[model samples]
Target: MNIFDNDSEVLQIGALTIENGTDSVILSGDVEITKTQAGKAQAQALLDFAQALCAVFDELDSQGLPATADKDPSKVVMVNNPFE
Candidate 1:
């Protein structure tokens, strides 16, 4: 099953543990893929995980809050609270 398909705080697939945080999603653990059928399955799982992440980015872009590759922390601007 696709772990990102639910609202659970934590989800697991094989050897990976995905933690839903307040501002980020944490991924931990290791998945080993050997030269066997089982290994191919594991590789597919990894690809699914990556595709899920891309979906998230696409959703964000659709909402006009696109994710950027900017790595400079100084470029961050604090704006007035919109809820106030």
Candidate 2:
């Protein structure tokens, strides 16, 4: 059988998707925010997700891939705060 054919195995796997070019972030599955531990875990999970994008492009650059030199896409330095 293929991997993850059992329901119990599926529960242990989580997927996170992030798109640096479009400024998008996603967390896999439903999140429970009632507990402080759960909330912090979810937030940290997202932060780690964004960081993973840098390695992808860095690998491409190491391979001599042509990329725009005008901007540093991996560094998420400033965020637009609407409440400010």
Candidate 3:
């Protein structure tokens, strides 16, 4: 399941819990992979999660908005409309 989907707010894969927020994304839980087949699958899922985050970062970069941009809404200053 795509955790980035609009309908998905919380997604749990293996021992990882991902929470999608309005202004942030939260990740909780520990990922411990053993040497068994289940461990391999868990490792793959972790990799996929990392790749997905990378893709989201890339998309944000393409939009001229870096992920590290200041997110303080209170610090935002409204400017006068130039078209007015």
lDDT of each: 0.71, 0.46, 0.75
State how far residue 45 of model 3 sits from its true place (Å).
0.8
The C-alpha stretches of model 3 lying farther than 4 A from their native spots are 1-7, 67-84
Q: Is candidate 2 or candidate 3 better by lDDT?
A: 3
Candidate 2 C-alpha error for residue 37, in Å:
1.5
TM-score of 2: 0.35
TM-scores of the models, in the order given: 0.57, 0.35, 0.66
For model 1, the stretches where C-alpha displacement exceeds 4 angstroms are: 1-9, 66-84
* lDDT per residue (tens digit) for residues 1-84 in model 2: 112123222111124322223222233555454457767776776565445545655765698866545467777588799898
lDDT of model 3, residue 70 = 75
Best by lDDT: 3
Instruction: Answer with 1 or 3, whichever has the higher TM-score.
Output: 3
lDDT of 1 at 66: 34
What global local distance difference test value does model 2 have?
Answer: 0.46
